[model samples]
Target chain A: MSDAAARLAYDVIVDLVGRGSRVLDLGCGDGLLLARLMAEKGARGTGVELSQAGVQAAIARGLSVVQGDLDQGLADYRDGSFDWVILNQTLQSLVNPSLVLNEMLRVGKSALVGFPNCGHWRARWHLLLTGHMPQQASLDYRWYDTPATRLLTIADFRSYCGERGINIVREVFLTDPDGGRPTRWPNLRAETAIFVLAGQIEGRPRQRP
Target chain B: MQPRSVGIVKTEYVELFQPPNELRLDSGEKIGPITVAYETYGTLNADRSNAILLCHALSGDAHAAGRNNEEDAKPGWWDDMVGPGKGFDTSKYFCICANVIGGCMGSTGPSSTNLRTGRPYGLSFPVVTIADMVRVQRELMRHLGIERLMCVSGGSMGGMQALQWTVDYPEMVLSAIPIASAAQQSSQGIAFDVVGRRAIMSDPKWRGGNYYAFGDPPLDGLALARMVAHITYLSEVSMRRKFGRRLQDRERYGYDFATEFQVESYLYYQGDKFTQRFDANTYLYITKAIDYFDLAASKGSLAEALREVTAKFLVIAFTSDWLYLPAQSREIVSALKVNNVDVSYCEIESDYGHDAFLLEVEEQERLIGNFLSGVAREHGIA
Candidate 1:
């Protein structure tokens, strides 16, 4: 995409958010996301990032970022402190993804979660014949460097959301197999999956420090 | 016309009732049974509702507006904004401006006698914060018999104190205008202060911050600190406009440490001139006070601390101010908004840097005048 296109998209997202709403972004790489949101939306954002370089970059970008191990917990932030907590491209990287999802549900009034789908038929064949973890376009890295703790399929995600009573406000499926236009059956054909969650809450858990 | 100067409260009366004082700073130090010095213009109404307090910046004195003497070269800094039919319009409001707690002017400062030591406190004066300055102002207001103020206004360090007042006694203030100030001093801000203090300490006559006994103050260090800080007060564009690498005497560079350029010479002149009247230790104390001023940290929650502020707010920040920056003003606005405080904010387009608060006349006067008029009308004064 063009640089201007990306910037415009960011601006659109900020415009969608209201002023003074506390925002939390999982895998918040650098604070550009938060700083841009603060400037355009007049919102206050706190980011949870993993890398030292990312944390420093966020601070320089004038966004508040906290170093955290997302796999362990997000207990520091008080419940309901955030209006919309987002986990972008980071759900599948967790050892126990359910625990983190529960924490997100607890802390945020709404959530925006995006993940990669592993239920694609091609991936099933690659796993069945090659007898190795499938290296699809979305999971590009070599086996050693790959970050998928356990692959999650589109069906699996939907079932968990339903069982846990987490409402799916919007579900977006990206089937852009190449650099070109997206196709159908994105869960099996597409590289990325985007889902925005809102409203519903279930499976209440006890508070942990 | 001759510059008019009147003791709003004479020295004797001020000492007796509204005496200036110092803090036993958070660092286990004490400042004074301070002798605050101030001047007032216009008259206080029977209801005392017409009072407007003017908080001056770091280098300011009690002479906020109006001339202190007929022989004075220039009128006070805010004189244009606070006089008959002027911005603050003292004719319609009782305007009060006091030198802050740890100031030099005629107010109690490091030079003020310490009751326990029977000597000027010098370095012994405890570092005071913006909060302490506001507290002292409150004391003065109580002594002056003013129950509530129409407004509290200032820029830079004065802005810091003005904000402290609104948060400290929200009910007492009807309005607050804090211009070109930061909620917390940035790392760069503290770096300048640190270097300034180092400059003072490096001077041979500094005497480890107790130069009063030596009878020779650390003029060199103080001048250096002023030179550093003054550079930050003005923008690069302002400096370029005022002096664009223009030579002071001959056209070519001196090729030495000598200040050959007009800008360098101007800074030197400003520094040397200020050293004649100011104290090095007082610089240390006051700058430390400013550096320590973080309203959020002290109170823990910005929203709660400002929750009681029902007063209207006019928070102004200059675009050219890299020292304070617009972000600080935004933070203040954020806190105020969370508490549902009534406020109007503007990041004024100016290239004069933080000092724009003092230099910009027409824009400032118009905004302040109209604002006060609106508020006055609400109170039935206009």
Candidate 2:
């Protein structure tokens, strides 16, 4: 993803998180978003990153980040321990996305998930015209070496959440990364998607933004 | 650039716990007129916020860096990691290291004279625990007028002391780095200590822990104990690399009940060398203290024990450290996370086993240097 899109996603997530909230950023590469949450939103933030270099960079940035793989799950945190759990720009790369998504909702009152939309028009055109795996600015990786295990679109995520009875408290689809505009027909037009999901425990009231 | 040493350091003695006022041990006993042997590197800032306490491991002393005398051939135990611009960074932070009460290196221990009997304390020295060690160090810090420490760090048994400090005096420690250590000593670890103690007690020259006047201080027993404990500190891979099944002196095996293999010869040398400095009684007491360390035993859980700990933490483990496995460090990290403490954990890849904390200096330097600088910034330390 472009730096502008990443920054826009961060802005949206920062706005979604309340002041002084506790946050756990999963797959927090270099802890940039977590640092922003702590500095700008007054949130108590922790991060978990898989890469050694990423964890080192985060620590050097003065951020608390545990070096761990997302596939292992967040068994260390208690239920409702965090106000917000974030998995941004790293959803497709996980081997067990469902487990992590469920674990996030279990551990936090709410969760914010962001990913590049694989159904964007450019990706479709590249695949349809060239008869090869799609590669674009948002999902820019060769099929052989890509870390993404499950390429997904905005619609797919919405239906997956609906099937699992997970509530989407808020949604933002970014068409113009620099402009920060939320585009319609996001599955086809938007390059990236962000969703704020409420905790799905039985009888628990949905949290307000 | 070559790492600069603290250079020509001397061990300082402070008499704590006067006759009337004594230090209370975890075993419900009190000892008086305790002398603490400590060494300091760098200068304590005016506000004293730059002070960092370094706890040493078993068989270690207060001399953590630099030479005690100009003619001394070797530096302190942690010389590689505690100097100007090294991990502890004497140039940036005031580092203090004190020998535990149950120690032989210039500290009041089993070898110290009993004021009443005018003989070595020997078995008469009250049994000490890790908490007791921390308590003495706390008194030393108080003597120096440092109310709060910027950080407390160590590896192995030293790491246990660091952990003990955070729990025993939560308000005083700003940050901690417990490397290659567990919150509790495992049964397997206790077994090793027990065997080592047995080696000392079975020797006739030990004379029921009263070999001080005999002029023969159970060298064989002490050497055997060192040999047993030394094996725990090394990995099979390291041993293979250092000395496989190779012969000691001749190309062919002696084929006798002697130190034939190079590994056997190495262990004998290590054992003999250790007896020259370490006290057998002190070893027994310190290992007993290590065996008694269990951070969660009374608190019900590790998280409960750490709930009041406000210090930021950096817990590190080595991949090949079987004595204190990576899983144990992860247990600490998990508990710290459950309490919402700011903690960073890394299981460094190394084949050096339990000794990696001492051998893997470069990686530790980078991680600890960055972590401490970040902590200093957060606390507004110069």
Residue pairs in clash, model 1: B19-B36, B20-B34, B20-B35, B20-B36, B21-B34, B24-B29
Clashing pairs in 2: none
lDDT of 1 by residue, B115-223 (tens): 7879987766667888888877887898799989999999998888888888789889988889899777788999999999999999999987778877788999999
Error of 1 at B335 (Å): 1.3
Q: Model 2 — TM-score against the truth?
A: 0.94
DockQ of predicted candidate 2: 0.68
- RMSD score of candidate 2 (Å): 2.7
Looking at model 1 chain B, report the run of 10 residues with the lowest lDDT sum: B4-13
Cα lDDT over the full model 2: 0.91
The CAPRI quality class of candidate 2 comes to: medium
Q: What fraction of the native alpha-carbon contacts across the interface, defined at 8 angstroms, is recovered by model 2?
A: 0.66
Q: Evaluate model 1 with DockQ and give the value.
A: 0.02
